[model samples]
Target: MATFHHYPFCPQSRFIRLVLGEMGIAPATVEEKPWERSQSLLMINPAGHLPIFVEEQGLAVPGAAVIAEYLDETRGLGLDGRRLLPDHPADRVEVRRLMEWFLVKFFEEVSAYLVTEKIYKRFMKAELGGGPPDMAAIRAGRSNVRYHLQYIGFLIGKRNWLAGPDLTYADLAAAAHLSCVDYLGDVPWEEDETAKAWYARVKSRPSFRALLTDRVPGMAPAAHYEDLDF
Candidate 1:
């Protein structure tokens, strides 16, 4: 079996996890703290990041994007579910665009702020930059999430999925980030019913079960977190 080094509440890491789950791959996971920057983790990925996917044969894939692509290329097809990458060139481009938008734009503007300020700061050791949470950063991230949810609604209205007719990596990436924020109960789903409905659909997928059931030690998920109807 492959080994995955990642942390709970990490958006990028969640993306890779969902991809692996969707592909029916069960990997042994090692939770790592990027802030601690362990020497062993650095040896595998100089970037000192979470989510280093290592194969039993010693093939190591660092970074969520690389791991996702690797899984897609190697075990993307002939599985129980639909392929995460689209077959058509244009559709693939759209999926890539949406994937980058969520992984980068959404994270930079919103998810990262909340994850860092709320989760990391609360649990991480003070020497490693963890302490009291930053309310201002959390506020900014909460405000920014509305726009991103609207965008998801817009995309879902046009296509059956985020990228096209099939549920691609774009949907998984978006859900991964949203799932992190949602755990903190930051998303204003009630403000946008369409987006809430769309999320409800994605949340019911078999691949999302693990994410919904995930718990972060002292912290608890929202009342509606594991509620498929919510």
Candidate 2:
């Protein structure tokens, strides 16, 4: 069996897990705290990142996009109507476009903030010295999240889903980050009916059930965290 080292409630970890589930591959799950490096993580990926994918062939894959594509290729997933990438070339371009948007732009503007403060706070130690999450940064993330929600609302209004006609990697990426925030009670679902409806669809996925069940030691989930209908 393949091995995966990751922390629960990690967006990148959740992203690959969902893809693995989609690919019909099961891995031996090992929980890893990435604040400090370990010999095993070093062996898996010299960079020592979370969400490490160790394949049956002993190939270690790092980064979510690369891992997603690798799993899709190896497991014959993300094809036809069931594809995780968009079918049309233009739409495929758009999928990559939004994939970067959520993974990079959203991460820089939003996920960095909330995840740092809420998720990484107690779990992190001062020796890491990246500095404790800035309250201003977290507050800004909360503000930016509202605007991001509005943008998602507008996008969803224009197209049924975040990427295009069918659900794709962008959808999962967006959900992955937002679920991290939503788990911290930071998402305002009431802001947009379309976004809310879209969320319910994302939440109801079989890939998402495990994420909803994740608990972070001292933190309890938000009121609607586990409610599929929410």
Candidate 3:
């Protein structure tokens, strides 16, 4: 058995959780607040990041991409054709590319602003720069998200999944970020019905149930956050 250290609202953490859920591996989880930079977390991952996966052998796999790849090599073998990383070289590259698009590019452009300002700030202490949400950042996030949604729609129009015909880490990564944005009511789902429909499909998966049930204390999810049909 492995142990997973994460923050519930963290998109990267959520992505790893979804991947583990898809693989049917339920590890014990420790909720972490990355902003705190707790010594315990630092000991395992000096980067002070969420989503650290610790193997039973005491090997600590820090970072979401590292954990995802570790799981693919160590646990995904049993999934056969259902492996989240496609076997073909080109397909594998596409999956990694989309993973980067969501986890890195999308996060930097949208989720980083919204999640940090709206959600994390609410829980952070004043000394740590916590206070009222930054409306400017929020507005920027809201405006930028429309473009990403349109991109999702464009991709879906040509492929069954974000990367290709089969579900992959690309979908999980994109859905992870969107789920966080959606939780904050920042995602403009109506702007792109294709993206909305694609999200609906991912949101309805068994692997997504845990995320749908997540509640962030003072901030409740949007009205339609958990609605399968929405």
User: Candidate 3, TM-score vs. the true structure?
Assistant: 0.97
Estimate TM-scores for all models: 0.96, 0.92, 0.97
Off by over 4 Å in 1: none
Model 2, C-alpha of 73: deviation from truth (Å): 2.1
For candidate 1, lDDT tens digit of each residue in 1-230?
A: 88999987899999988888778888999988766788999999998877899999989999987887788788886255667887788988998899999989999999999999988787779887899888889889999999999998888788888888887889889999999999999998988777788788878888888888889788999898899998
Clash pairs (backbone) in predicted model 3:
none
Most accurate candidate by lDDT = 3
Best-to-worst lDDT order:
3, 1, 2
Backbone clashes in model 1, listed as residue pairs: none
lDDT over C-alpha atoms for residue 185 of model 2:
91
lDDT of 3 by residue, 90-165 (tens): 9999999999998889999999899999889998899998999999999999999999999999999999999999
User: Which tens-of-lDDT digit does each residue in 73-151 have in candidate 2?
Assistant: 6665542328787457898788888878877788788886787777776677677745556789888998889988888
**Superposed model 2: Cα runs more than 4 Å off:** 78-81, 130-133
Residue 77 miss distance in model 3 (angstroms): 4.6
